[model samples]
Target: MNAAVLTALIALVSSVVGGAIVAAVNHHYSVKEDLHARRLDLSVDRLSEAYMFMLLNLTIDKDKHREYQIHLANIQLFGSPTTVSLTNNLMRRQAGEPVDVTTGALLSDILNSIRNDLGLDRIDTADLVRLNLGDEVDLLKRESSK
Candidate 1:
């Protein structure tokens, strides 16, 4: 090939290679980000479901407290350390291990974890504090009544 043709060919080859590299790198990053987001969504979903079961467990008439534990255990597979700690408090409370915590506190921790995982701003304290205090109180009373 002539010099000009050869130079043009080299330039085209380099451009194609560079473009491919960039695209591959971009795809790698996008996939990584997508996986991270999906994991977080799963964790939040699990936590939300667990919170529901926790509420059901609170009702003295129900016997689904043990089922509530399924969500908590699943969180361990996908949640961060803070999430695990918060769930542990609930476990302790259910076991009547004299934990110095309340339903509101556990709720707060779960809400905070969900918020953090979703990359949301700080939650309003007033909203988090509105949890009915009856669950923990009732659990205590039930223990004594038993």
Candidate 2:
């Protein structure tokens, strides 16, 4: 074979191999990203489930709101138990240590925002345990309806 034709053949093979390697890497990275997203989704689901359970408890007994609130406080503290910072006013009094009112308010806002994102209207203690959070809750119910 001519030298040029031989050189071209080698280059073609190299290109094909390089493309395959790149595609495999891209696919691996994409799967990793999807796994991360799934983990985050699971975390959100767990948090929502806990909230709903608390709501159910509150609905069953009027005076159980405080107990449910305590459960929520524990959930918040699970990651940063010694942070000495409160996220919501309702959680402040349950803190094991002193808390900053402003930080607590900010946290309250963040929690409320999450609830709003999940289609919750209000966070009243009376309705906390037994209220429908709208479409998001409906979707969850349908998913588990089986």
Question: Each model's number of backbone clashes?
Answer: 0, 1
Maximum-lDDT candidate: 1
Q: Give per-residue CA lDDT, model 1, range 5-115, as digits (tens).
A: 999999999999999999999999999999988877787888878666664455433465456556668766656676677667757876888765565555556767777
Tens digit of per-residue lDDT, candidate 2, span 9-113: 999999999999999999999999999777656545544554545434423365666666555554464313322133343355345546434322333333454
Question: Which window of 10 residues has the lowest lDDT sum in candidate 2?
Answer: 78-87
RMSD of 1: 5.1
Give me the overall lDDT of model 2: 0.50
Whole-structure CA lDDT of model 1 = 0.66
List TM-scores for all candidates, in order: 0.72, 0.46
Task: Tell me the lDDT of model 2 at 64.
Answer: 69
Instruction: List runs of model 1 lying over 4 Å from the truth.
Output: 59-62, 124-146
**Runs with alpha carbons beyond 4 Å of true place in candidate 2:** 58-146
lDDT of each: 0.66, 0.50
